[model samples]
Target chain A: MSLAPDEVRNIAHLARLAIGDEDVPAHADNLSRILELVDQMQQVDTKGVEPMAHPLEGGQRLRPDEVIEEDQREAFQKLAPQTEVGLYLVPKVIE
Target chain B: MFEHTVAELSRLLADGEVTSEALTREYLDRIERLDSRFNSFVTVTGEPALEAARAADAERRAGRAGPLTGIPMAHKDIFCTRGVRTACGSKMLDSFVSPYDAGVVERLQSAGMVMLGKLNMDEFAMGSSNETSFYGPVANPWDEKAIPGGSSGGSAAALAARLTPAATGTDTGGSIRQPAAMCGVTGIKPTYGRVSRWGMVAFASSLDQGGPMARTAEDCAILLGAMAGFDERDSTSVQREVPDYTVGLGQSLEGLRIGLPREYFAEGLDDAVARVIDEAVAEYKRLGAEIKEISLPNTHLAVPAYYVVAPAEASSNLSRFDGVRYGHRCEDPQDLEDLYKRSRGEGFGDEVKRRIMIGTYALSAGYFDAYYLKAQQIRRLIADDFARAFEEVDVIMGPTAPNVAFDRGEKKDDPVAMYLSDIYTLSVNLAGLPGMSVPAGFKGDRPVGLQIIGNYFDEGRLLNVAHQFQQATDWHTRAPENIA
Candidate 1:
């Protein structure tokens, strides 16, 4: 369950967090310890247990699927850090 | 002067003994004088509160207003309030003034409840203690050196210290009940979907439920009436009609079956806390409630399962906090990747980052089935345990925390120990049932809480039981004398 330095760095990248070089060792150690604990779950017998997606039963308890308000994308987009022509701007993946 | 419960304040406000302006100013001054020591509030809305008080007075003059009208209360910083800075105790939302009110805020405001301010909490509602808050740890009003159990610690502390009559709190795991227990107040986490999470900042969506924190169960019932509803905006909002929460406050507990979960009362429970809880249960027996020894066999897995599932959901929920959104962003970045990384890194606190990392790891491609899927399965077993136990008993009883509030630095270094602090309370959230904590008795100088959990949509019954306890005991009315 030990996460190597490089693996920790990769996790930091995927999580979009900046980890200082010194902080990495501690983060890796802490994460390693946590994973060790989480790994204990595998030992428990959960063969026939059904997965619980929602705590409440009766199939998601969803509200009526009706439009309550008009679209406000333009107004909401105004709060974004970077946007152009109603679309959010992000680092270019293609190019 | 500051010891009035919401019920007492309502009577005074109704009888013209206290003006809304006077009541609002009294609590505001108390918060001003004492909050620096406790760090209970992140943002104190003085002007708006005064304005609301004046309007409430005008409503009273016009001969229209309810018991809660003009009564001041605080909200956990998680709820988004229109024109107010609603930072969920994180630097990520340091400057985020919400444009719209959360459903709970709007509903309570419509009830004419004056806003005292926003209380501090764990960032994104992630921690068992309030130390994770960017604003700083909330001091337990009983002992300033001790920690206030959280992420509803501020509301609990403030209410316990008489800063606000009652406040709104969202419980994802132990957030509401744990703090109420630690701070010697009464609070309830209503049945899931009973209160809308529409504009409340998301943590673990399925588990996050907003309810009320107050000094007494009756006061909590009044606040619950204002906060509970079915909102069309929130996809999971229940469609059931709201009930008058205070209707059954005085209901007799005769023939009520109180279940004592063997797992909850087993090892790791502190002797002092067990004694206090047993004393409270004994009182219920004397009140004619039948006590039963029921078993929730899967209780031991609650903490492990919650740690995995909560963080997994949090990892997905917190992805919205990248640089290209409203919240904190880095000053400058070499590239877009740097922007996303540095912005998120500098914004979230250590505990939040730790949860995000744990969540990311569990949800990763190779580990999803082993960690995330397995945790979900364990969650079902835990809920099923409660379901079976509830079928045999009307309510479940236990100690809210393993022990009373510890010193601030006691569990700071050990996250697992802090996580274990929530063991008895997390199963209720995982089951999506109504649960409450009422002041039972004292352990040494600190007060202890007896947890009362009810089945789904059984909030009225839970409050009635809590009210019945408060009626026989005056523990809920006692306040810490030296708050500063």
Candidate 2:
């Protein structure tokens, strides 16, 4: 179950990484080796074994829905790379 | 005084043998003399430390000081400390000053421990060695040429160099223990949910655990006492009562069944590491502990499983950093896509970006079942292996790493080799169990660690065992003569 170079390139694209064409072979090789290592999982009979998302099992712990404190957006936003008043600045999404 | 444990310092402070100001000054002076070489601290807060010291003195004068009062400690940069620049070791959060305190920071402050500064770590706590830190690598106190094991490398180095009596560290995959082992210090990653993760910058949610790093197991136990508790803020915070970790330190180890996993010693282990761990087990036998060989057949799958699960979680957790409400944003965005791309590309390091991509791919729609689902099942088998072993033994022991701390660039180019260094440590996190590293002996000039694996919330026993070992051996007490 080795990963193909194109598969690695596709995964890289999905991950939003700008991998160069030259680096594709190395990344493909590494990813394929990792996938090969993971191939060992197929030998285990996990058909009846339920997938464990987290180690602990219980109802989701929730806090009070109501706000217990005031907003610190003004102060926090000052640390952001770009912000204006309360709005976070980004490149315009639409024309 | 510089070599004294946190427990010793606290006692002297309470008895008026030393003032908080003097203690702070001593530590500050040591940090000043040594930090240049160690590179342990990213930001050393002089004004804040002195102010807290004075307040600690006043608190003592008012007879309101707790055990940790007036004692100095530092935080790993991952904790969002109020008014402090809590950079999670990336250029992204380099200028970000946290508006609020992490739950651990708040709790430690309540205990009256003075904040020294923020220690260095792997960028976003992603790497095993602290080299990935944006600020630079933290040097091992034992030998400046060698790395202090990381992502809590700075904390471990600082403690070893006597920069601070103790410091806080987070372990995802042996981050705390590896560095502790390399620097010849003691640190423990408590059972998951033992310490609140609120205000902690999430790396891998299921694996990230905050714990104590210090000069001794006793110091670690005391710090853990203050750090572990229920917090409504952290959803994963356990509702179980926090035990006094120091209560059973004096308990005997007679009749204790110590399990040595056969798989851990099977292959790829260095001779020096194997020898030191064998010596540690012999000492345990001398302490009346019964030793037996156990098998965790699923151990090899841990690293691969962790790579999948951790990256998947990291990819999701880091999605919040997309030119967001705080942290690095693109200078000028031609479009929203450009903003995200440049911001992330510019902000994160090569390794962090690599992990994010790996995680993103693993969790992508078509591959999710084959990659993420399969990893989760393997994660269960890894955990179940521990469950079966624990039923037969009180605790497990193994070499913390396959080899001693390597040269700076030894495994940097080889990501697989670097990943394999964590083979022994990853299974513990996969199983969500508690583990600690105590200084066993040296491999050449570099220090080796004897890892003790405990059942859930068995921190007290683990600490006691390490403490007992420290008492019997001087390895924990030995410091590099060149330091300070």
Candidate 3:
């Protein structure tokens, strides 16, 4: 039930996080303790128990798919770390 | 000026006894002078606050003022305030200025409440002790070395220090109530959808709720009235009429059914905290409430279940912060993956990263069913326990935290011990019930709070119950004597 250092590293990669080598042991130890805590779920007989995703016991209200507002791309993009001509710029994804 | 409740200040402003400009100046001065010791305010908007106050005065002269008109309130940095940096206490957002107001901020502004400024919080509302802030930890005003329970520590600490008469806070797991408990203030987290979450940054969306924090339940009511309502922008916003939370303040507690959950009073609760809570119950009994012993058997599962569900949701919600759009970006990235990985790694703190990794692992291949699904099932069981208890008792009562505030750095190195700080308060988030902490009494110099739990949309009754209790005790009025 405990996560090994490699397993922890794998999870971090999946999460798109870079854990320093010096920090991995502590992360591994803490994550393992938490997993041990999560293991307590095995004792409960949750047969057919519904997985409650939200506290509200109702379905999400859907709105009609129509343009109902003005565009604010420029305003929104102002907070981006790098942007050009109203487009968000990231490190080049394709060579 | 700082000592008066929001209601009292409103009355003075309405009666022409105090000018909004004068009142705002006094509080701003207090914050400037005392906040260094408190560390409660992350950003203090003096010029805008004074400007807003003058506008309020003009509104009053023009006969256009409302109850909260001219009142100065602190906002937890989680809510987006247009033209201000809403950091959410994380370096990732250190440079991000919001373009729009959060739903709560917009409503409160329209009601004429002026913003004192944004208060600090645990980074991304992820930690309990407020130690994870990119801004340093907020000191408990009661005892400087003591920790103010968080992630709404700034809001609660400010209230305790009287830096702001009214403040806004969010609760996901025990963020609102735990700090209120530790700092001797009143805070209420209404039913999940009672308040709009549109612009309040998401952290475990299902459990996160924005609410009011202040010196008294009545102040909480006045703030909550303006804060809670349905919004078209928040998909989960309930289609229900927002009640006037103030109207129910004088209701009689006679024949009120109070449930004392057996599991809550069991092992692990601090002896002094339990004694303080018992004294509050005795006062409630004196007020003619009938108490019965009840149990939420799945209560033990709440901590583990919340750790799983919240982190999983946070991992998904926080993915939007990946270097490209808003927030921090890494320097000289060689590749896209490196950009994202380094930005996130350097941007988030230790606790936040730990949760993200755990959540990523829990939802990863070969583990989703065993962790995420299982935790959700436990969530259902926890909610069922509350539902069954509510069918019998009108309201539930317990200690808000296992103990009063611990020293800063005492449990910081021990994450599991730190996580247990919210043991008594997390179940309410799990069930989406309305819960609050009212100043009950003192365990020595530090304050202890009585946690009041009510069923869904029971915010009015919860405030009324606390209001009744406050009328009988002066605990909420008790400030940090050691500070001054």
* DockQ per candidate: 0.57, 0.59, 0.85
lDDT of 3 at A87: 79
The order by descending TM-score is 3, 2, 1
lDDT of 1: 0.89
TM-score of each: 0.96, 0.97, 0.99
Best by TM-score: 3
Q: What is the TM-score of chain A alone in each candidate?
A: 0.70, 0.85, 0.89
Query: For residues B1-484, could you state the per-residue lDDT of candidate 3 as single tens digits?
Result: 6778999999999999999899889888888889898789999999999999999999999999999999999899999999998999999999989999999999999999989999999999988888999999999998988888899999999999888889999999999999999999999999999999999999899999999999999999999999989999999998899889999999999999999999899999999999999999999999999999998999999988988999999999988889888898989998989999999998999999988888888899898999999999999999999999999999999999989999999988888898888898998998999999999988888889899999999999999999999999999988897545
* Among all candidates shown, the one with the greatest lDDT: 3
Q: Write the per-residue lDDT of candidate 3 for residues A21-67, one digit (tens) a residue.
A: 99989998999998888788888989999999988877778889999
lDDT tens digits by residue: candidate 2, B98-217: 999999999999999989899999999988889899999888877788888888999999988989999999999999999999888999999988899999999999999999999889
Per candidate, the number of residue pairs that clash is 0, 0, 0
- lDDT, model 2, position B65: 88
Q: What stretches of model 1 exceed 4 Å from their correct place?
A: A58-78, A82-95
How much DockQ does model 1 earn?
Answer: 0.57
Q: Score candidate 3 by TM-score against the native.
A: 0.99
